[model samples]
Target: MSPACFYGDSSALDSILGISRKKTEGALGQHPPSVSYVKAEQDDLLGLQPDEPANPKVLRVAIIGAPNAGKSTLSNTLLGRKVFPVSSKVHTTRCKAYGVITEDDTQLIILDTPGLTSPTKAKRHNLDRSLIQDPWDSMKHADLVLVLVDVSERWAHTCLSSQVLQCLSRFPQIPSILVMNKVDLLKKKALLLDLVTELTEGVVNGKKLHVKSLSRTHLDPARNNPLPSIPACTPENAPKDGGCLQEGSEVQRGPGSDTSCDAKASDSGHVLGGTEKAQTATPQVSRDGKIKKGWPHFREIFMLAALNGEAVETLKRYLLMQAKPGRWEYHSKVLTSQSPQEICENIIRGKLLEYLPQEVPYMVLQETELWEEGPSGELTILQNLLVPKETHVKMLIGVGGQLVSRVAREAGEELMNVFLCDIHLKLCVKLKK
Candidate 1:
């Protein structure tokens, strides 16, 4: 068996139906029993990778970048959904977000990690345990890492981008892609290309500035009022500030013209390698009938570089090409895995069972467990909202259970859209407090 491939133990799966991990040869006899195992072909799990896996394989790719590098934009664009948040502001993405893209029922879970900065960004801000810690932990599960860099800005401002590339280069064997993100704003495109493909991408000392957070309204096209038609709004290719809008700002549509609502962005500018000035053309409709807008330089270039079959297909192939040796030995593909419905239900139930007051003094952290199906086409979620301090309990809980009611309604409504059905969410807080 190749280290990249996995052989699920369909034959000798043990059963522990008695609510515990006990000795049981009759495990296979249990009804609704779930047993799965994986076997790898290579004995040297950490040795040089095989050209082709000896057996079934599980490949992993992790997309990483510095904050505000268009990591979310590229991922969502690649995933073809608003799965991750893409905002002009820095740190809009607080943690790791996972989206499993499946084709013909075959699934690949793509993990989007928060920008890994030097000295780390966790030390600052009021980030709760759940808000960002998830991304940091994602590394342990990653097989390949896609490093993203916002080329539109100056290299001086990229705190850990160079360092990250340095860290990745050390592996040499852990296939990695250096993504030059936000290239739409750069004046010279070639300057960022070599590094983007071979190893790393960035202007050694190019000038770039840090961006500030904007009102949530900026990201939503419907909400942002148009820039003054007069062009004083500076219809530049990309905002110098990495796109957080300015005060009294006219519609600051950049080159890659987007006409979602009343506003319209200009077309994307071309970066034709070398010293040639970029060109901009009008947007056009694709043969598939979807309107295609211009992507800034780094994104546009990277898109072409990584294009294999289709965009998503390219990603699958790229990850597979980058898969390391013996990584599959640690993983298995099991049939009858938990479905989204089951996961959501478990999230609800766990929340209900762990109910606690918001003002609890001692308890610190909480995590959602499972979600169950509800009658009348509703969803019942299981989750635990944990807290570090157990002492602040009374203050967090108010009269008539007002907060608990509010929380249920809010969570229920959110889950309803994803589940494609009404939701009856339940909650609980488990706290040491």
Candidate 2:
């Protein structure tokens, strides 16, 4: 099938590409589908059953942000365990959902997605960049969107990227919360006020966010504000129509939102913006089809650090309180939708991203070659780290394979903790021809 037809329709694409599936599968060394295409097929291929209508409420939350914004770390913190891998590198998470928190009355299925990036920057290499859009795609499947912003960095213009704005604009009615992550890293506490103002107004560098769609020549940051400044709406003045302001009452920031002195803080896939949900008017787009300037109005603001377990409980409580009359989508016991092999692959990849330098991490891929279950509930796993060049392989192996061994040791410890059993992890670095 032509590249244009690949994303047209799953069934049509599948039918047209029938002959190529075998060859594609073989080239990855009997590997599972590439990261870009796995989400499309994971559920259909696994045949995992949905929840049995036991719980009265279910909250499908989508955690979205730019690469290295710590979405995975937040997910792990929320679940009270590490089901997803946290990495400093970009695009650590492809498309994966973890049915993280389970309450007696509510089940929160967290959809962890790839970080959002500009399509042009993502597709520059022509490598499989499909996962770049996964965050936006996951937004359609979400009942609530937790927009994670890195507040540690100063805001020159807007807090969010254009990609995030475009996705939120597409679903104007879906209430979202602006979560200011890594606030602990903020050296100046007073800057928080400025950060909040910039995010609400969607202005950056004292100018409205620049988008390719609007007439760029007409917009002068000093002369005209292309995007209207959104009126600051506090919780007391929120709209009553269950629209823009409804999401604010759900979270209370700082020590006042039922928490003291610390701050912090979707579903395993059914596409966002399904027909079952109510639809609102689509936001205006520029003539060139580029996203017009408009900052998103968060339902509420949550400031928390996911790494230090700061205010994570407060965020969890807010989610539980969102429970309404609905059936749970995932089984009560399941923590994530990912298979064992996929989890192992993510774990190993996280280590490489942490330890490897330069372009080596991005050019390499890891796959679980074997997963043997022992009688005592232990797991023996073997994974291969595939590199494109011989030099890359040597970098991965280090001198006398010391680097690989270090990666293996750290990966094994985490695996043991997550799986709750003994793990013997073996890493093999191979140069891909």
Candidate 3:
């Protein structure tokens, strides 16, 4: 199908392209099909992806970002869950983070990795601590990669710049999209636009390199927006014979609605202004030669915006456009790459704990020694918080043990919350040196 420009209610655009319509009817009222050909050419990367014969293939995407760059937010939004740790503090992530997207027999596995740069060298030069290159090691093998930048932070500092260049260098071949994270902090879009231009001109081996930006936002303003409203009434008429609108299949607008709005021919594969749940609208020609809204898949559009950005109609069209139909596809399904045990081990390795400074100014390290499982699947664990220097320990203990009481109470509460059982957590600070 040729690219078609869709016009209608301003609110309707939300569902017309990326979103579905039944999801937006309450806001824009039902309508007859308004069809027009999309006459513009632009970036449609979704159209240029790996697919199967008549099936939508999952797109494996990796997101690489600086410490505390809202990588977790993007991951959480994509997964529609809170599996990874998120914090205002830097280095909340140490190992690679994973999220999966599965819809309409297709699954997309997403990988989020630790920000990589040179830390040892950065500290010596009084520069920003760099992203550890360890994560980039994985980028060596990715179908697609997304490099994220904190739009909230000004484009200064050599460490991040170095890491950004390093990223482009590593994934010179794979398509990469630069996502300007935390966009809520910046009002001047020029800053982000300018940053996009500069990043497209990154470097390799300290030499100038160029690339393209996929899709981005300082932050997705609509990340948690309300779900699109559904209609209270279905079309007074329905489609006929599992085919185009028969004799009386007239999908009409809601009460007090006008047909003056531009008829949209959406690539989402839905006829303009049709409900998403029940039927797919095909712009049926009227006796007057003007097309009325025939396709309605609005619910599917909202679903895509809420989860990963793939509507059901788009999925079908994507499958059909590839011209390859398939009963099965490998890439579209979410495959568990790492097991629970493996994830736990990765965390315990202290590899992902880079968020903890080398010299934690006011904190210390503690490790549990044993775990005793109890009835109802509860657990009792014993641990000791270790500290150095007698003075520090005494200071923590406080005169009359007041300090110890507060500290012990806080620790016990955390333990109980984490294990959800009786925590016989003991506290003792030994002075070393």
Candidate 4:
């Protein structure tokens, strides 16, 4: 069949597109600044100043974890808006996206990054370079790091992903938190405690105690045996020489200077490097400098379901409280750094990922053909979905074009909600060649 085309109509398109519908008296064809710019300008005209606190605060948090670990969901929940795209497919976020939350004198900037993957796996799959570098870059600029783990997954109960371990080990200086996401899916509450114990290696509430062997049977002898008691590395007991003390090695550093620690060999013979200052509790590292268990240095542990937004507020409050005195980087009205076109593309991509079958969505490329304002203050958008193979185009269009239609309709509704205006969206599926 020929390429299928679908159209979406909604009322709030002009607002979302940052276009001004009201005409001024003096100039012809002179459009006003965007809504955000106008609002800021109005504030200036009215002499409206923020009630600045004694110490205005800002916190930049980087959320990192394995693929599909609810990082984007949590970020949207915290921001109280769905600016980030989310789907069941892994690597839905191709690069680092920023979400902003401003309350009173505090502004929290969330760095929603692409999921972490090993270098080999990334190269083998020919994934985007951002998938490997973005997380580290986010960590370098972050004041705090949230390590989100999908607790419902069985793999989480055994050990954290190697990529997660690498992140924790690399940026030991930044205060990190352990967020056990998707807790609502886990039925047995007792197993949650066991999983925590196993991950934390019997360290709870800043106290170290002997934890019995986990009830779950595992083939790895290292996990089955009782782990040795390692002193919890807190800032109070950290090395006085302005560096983190790990077992026998001393990470030396000058005062107020950031330095990288030498690469240490892991128990598995992997060499992990790029170390920073150690400010929090250190994870249980192998003698050769590899992380063997969960990061014990997490200043806090939170359990929440990002999908339902349960306990997310509590986490948000905690992060807010952690903010220190700093100037706000973004205006309070700004929700994200993404442009309108980027947002629309992500929404459509998310829908395609949700509606299309395995590997098809990943293989599809999206291009915006046209974006213009209609006479009645509606947005008209035309986008194309380019598939590499003709068979893939058939799959995207579905029988009688039902699949593509569903993707278009749902995406339009979401776009309408996001823009708060009427939108006319057209989608066409075409062969890439």
Candidate 5:
């Protein structure tokens, strides 16, 4: 039997019952194993009967949100591999990259898209057109949409971004779910219930509901002291003092614990939609009958910390169960549609963003000088960093080229792990003008 098949196993039972088992510590951080692929026609050992049905199961999910909302982290976590590059900087993913996850008979094509920005912001920053266009384009072909929000960030926790709301309003037909990411950093556990009530407008899976309030006498201390207004970490405004927190990094202010609120709370007191009763309450609709603040039609709400893979298994299983009969798009062994060079470019760019100070990484451009493999099955990559300014070139190279050396070393290490082979990566900094 093929390794992908889980027939008669406990995993199969878990899938049926919607149970998610936490991954082991070793399994949580390990890279996916490399396997040789055989053509579907030539291989009949996929654990499928010869007379099986013609249609296979497939699902295309588009993860959309504001910049730095852990979209790439969630994508990598769901795929069980780090195919996409992630950093503290926003707009790290400049386009829509596809990551495929095939388990048994289901194939999940994840569209990791660029952050959604308004047209004015895009033009002001002279950003790539893809940053504004790709999110909508991804939704055009998506079977499901996941609107991710960084609940730990003060600016994003209370309300959805305007662009996100517009996207949800534009595509009312597509099924979307609100994914509240970074729950580990949310100090006040009680705020989760309020955040959910605000974002979903008290509607979960088409049902109007309310959250049972905690006793005023027993108010949580953390609730009294809310998180400070720290702007969402983006490339233009990333702290120069190295104060920005990256994904998976812990904050010293609070204890990290998994918290979730059930939608089946009492139907009384301070209805979210401002009605006296839950049954009579409804989402805030505009004059054209479209949602105004948050999406009311979210099919489900998932609270997860994508950085450490917490609660991610449940979301993955839920997505697998949502798959319907369709033709498979790619081979089972394929994890991503990005080519080696593209992957390399993204990884290098991510490292540059991570190590370099504000605005330097974004200003630098990459060019492939050479890509070759050795006789011993190792890879050699020569890439150039093109900077517009002489000072920028110096910044990239650093004193005695220490900075660039670190970027190359760390990037090559990650590349070796990703491709499962030794890599000789050389980087050169050049002045473009």
Candidate 6:
């Protein structure tokens, strides 16, 4: 009498039908162009049962970094598709989203979370508060962390944000990989070597990491064109990113290397003691004036351009190989867990960021009003762009409404590609009271 073991719901009809699946063929047995219904008993509902065998391995990786550090770009690249919206502005990602990678014997679940930044008193919207806390929330569920660093920046070595250092310090138990992103932008090859050496030695907070170096200089075998070369490009043959995706070999786990970090005591630093409180707050700075002592030891290091699909394949393979045996948390075929509405919101906001002036991007907000699906695989989306000032609205509208038209066109085109249907995107510019 255990409620008759209702899997999804106890509805009598669903219980009798077991599981209902939809098919493309018509219910009337029509060929080539209609839809139909199918019913099947799936053991997948409860996942692998205790008595059942054949359980595959699963790995959950969390990608965290500073705002505009190419985290969304890297997440899209690793997922081999564009689900997370990408833009040049900060705070592009407002929540944690999953990008699933299904392989033969493993499934890699990637959590793409908002960039870690300190909460500000002025920007205290619910969304802003969520953005600051989402990364730490996702960290609790991660098996491993991929820390992406913007290596192309001039202050890349010493200008590590205090927020990032605090995050790394808080999670000393979880193993992390240091990913040096945007290496292709380096004009000089020697600078890469110097940067790597300095990064390995640079003390953060106060602890110096014993970093193991396995640096690969080349983005790909085709140095000039890092993206994998495709045989041809046609309407039917083109890949998502204008080329084939690069697939690299996984890094084999070797004997334990000494990558452990030690805690130090100072006016602002805390000593490494288990559950023992220090008398004085650990001064984040050491004698050398390093910011904090809670630096994390990176188990693996990778340098690649996520935009160009460099070394991304290697990163994927490594994650797959690192998978520990367990029940998969998500379905194999599900690329993203974001709803259609959420996807549209991100896309529209991203487009707005791209076309608007720097000052105007932050002054604007987008919200989806309505979503309707047409009979012929078409979509009608109604969204409103709210601006604080009428001047901002005027700017967004442009002369003769040209700027809004451009955004609609670009967003519709990308939407059509992802949803495989014509999109009618209606954007209204309204002044916020």
List candidate 6 stretches off by more than 4 Å.
1-53, 120-127, 157-159, 202-296
Go through the candidates in order and give the C-alpha RMSD of each one to the true structure: 18.6, 16.6, 18.2, 17.3, 10.8, 15.7
The residue-by-residue lDDT of candidate 6 on 1-433, one tens digit each, is 2222121111111111121211222111211111110101122321423231277898899998878788989987777656688888778788898777767667778899888887772166334677888899888899998888777777654345667676766776776766767867765433433353354333322223222222254234555422221121111222332222122211111133111211110111111111111123333556764555224255555666788776565566667767889887665545566655666778778888888877687677787787777787578888999999989989999999999999898888766655557889999999988
After superposing candidate 4 on the true structure, give the runs of residues whose Cα lies further than 4 Å from its correct spot. Answer: 1-54, 209-284, 287-289
Q: Which candidate is the best by lDDT?
A: 5
What's the TM-score of every candidate structure? 0.39, 0.68, 0.46, 0.72, 0.76, 0.67
Model 5 lDDT per residue over 253-285, tens place: 112211111111111111121112224233455
lDDT of 6 at 306: 84
Task: Give candidate 2's whole-model lDDT.
Answer: 0.59
- Tell me model 4's lDDT, rounded to 2 decimals: 0.65
lDDT, candidate 5, at 236:
21
Tally clashing residue pairs in candidate 1.
71
Q: Model 2, 1-433: lDDT tens per residue? A: 2222211111111111111111111111111121111233444534546454544787889988777788999888777656687778777776656645666667777899888877687677443565676776777888888888877755422457778788888787777777777867776433444465567553211222211222344344685422321122221222333212111112212221212111111111101111111123355567887664335345555567788766555566666666566776665556677865667778888889888996678778777687777787677888888899998888899998899999999988876666667889999999887
What tens digits encode model 1's per-residue C-alpha lDDT throughout 337-395? 23444334333332333343232321334455655555675655655566554443333
Sorted on lDDT, best first, the list reads 5, 4, 2, 6, 3, 1
Distance from true position, residue 348, model 2, in Å?
0.4
How large an RMSD does model 5 have? 10.8
Candidate 6 has its poorest 10 consecutive residues by lDDT at 30-39
Order the candidates by TM-score, highest first.
5, 4, 2, 6, 3, 1
Off by over 4 Å in 1: 1-58, 68-109, 126-143, 151-163, 182-372, 380-420, 424-433
Better by lDDT, candidate 3 or 2: 2
Q: lDDT of candidate 5?
A: 0.69
Backbone-clash count (model 4): 10
